[model samples]
Target: MANVAILELSRNCAKTVEEIVKLERKIFPKHESLASFFHDELKKKNSGLLYLHVDGELAGYVMYSWPSSLYASITKLAVKEQYRGQGHGETLLKAAVEKCRTRKVSRIMLHVDPLRTPAVNLYKKYGFLVDTLIQGYYSSDRDAYRMYRDFDSS
Candidate 1:
């Protein structure tokens, strides 16, 4: 049986950030990756990162930022190829959402490649609805779906 753990990263954890950057490079293209700005992102007051570990090995991570009191954005979610299809993405996402909820944000948002069916389905399962199609959001030839989930604040 695999032992699973989800941890909220602290801003000053350099070793963990290094590991996350390595995983980010493996999971995303250079143009879309957060590797170069990850450390700086963590330094922001409203940003947070949640990482997953399976049997002590890094499996995935989610980065989020609540820039304002009313909304939060999931900036990135990535799972190592070896860990794909094993529910690590969902775990990371759930944690990110819950974190935002605890902050009393009214909505959560993210952008995803429309062609990534599995990711789109996962977001849908979590109640995120597409807000619009972003032209060249990822690149000149790639488009993205801006998705969001609103919480009942009343």
Candidate 2:
């Protein structure tokens, strides 16, 4: 694994949005983030968008929103094809977890396609437990597992 840097994107950073859009297209064509959406999220205080770079090249990104509460929810997590299995995904997730802790969130949650075994395993390894099965989460043909990791076990 290479030394990767994670950056919290800013609204004025055009390059960050461009790179994120490209990576999103490559890694998740069905769920690509538009430039406008990136701009909006970057401008908001309750939302966060983070990108991971290896030697100045964009490798992956993670987006999450707190939505006026102490609950953190992950909107997207993606790594370029070439960067998968190189720990970038886990690194991104760790960063998100830390952010949630910094914001004093009670829990971090995310939805993942049931068929995405690797992602399911990764979340489980980090102490995330399946909360429920959401039918039509992505679409009528797709189902999702709602997973969460709570900071306060009590």
> Among these predicted structures, which one has the highest lDDT?
1
Candidate 1 stretches greater than 4 Å from native: none
What are the RMSD figures for all models against the true structure?
0.8, 1.9
Q: How far is 43's C-alpha from truth in model 1 (Å)?
A: 0.3
User: How many clashing pairs per prediction, in order?
Assistant: 0, 0
Error of 2 at 65 (Å): 1.2
Give per-residue CA lDDT, model 1, range 19-138, as digits (tens). 999988887899998899887899999999999999998888999999999999999999988889989999999999999999899999999999999999999999999999999999
Name every residue pair that clashes in candidate 2: none
List the global CA lDDT of all models. 0.94, 0.85
How many Å off is the CA of 80 in candidate 1? 0.8
- Could you tell me which residue pairs clash in candidate 1? none
lDDT of 2: 0.85
Could you tell me every candidate's TM-score relative to the true structure? 0.97, 0.91
RMSD of 1: 0.8
Model 2, span 36-57: residue lDDT tens: 4667666778888889999889
**Following a full C-alpha superposition, what root-mean-square deviation does model 2 have from the true structure?**
1.9
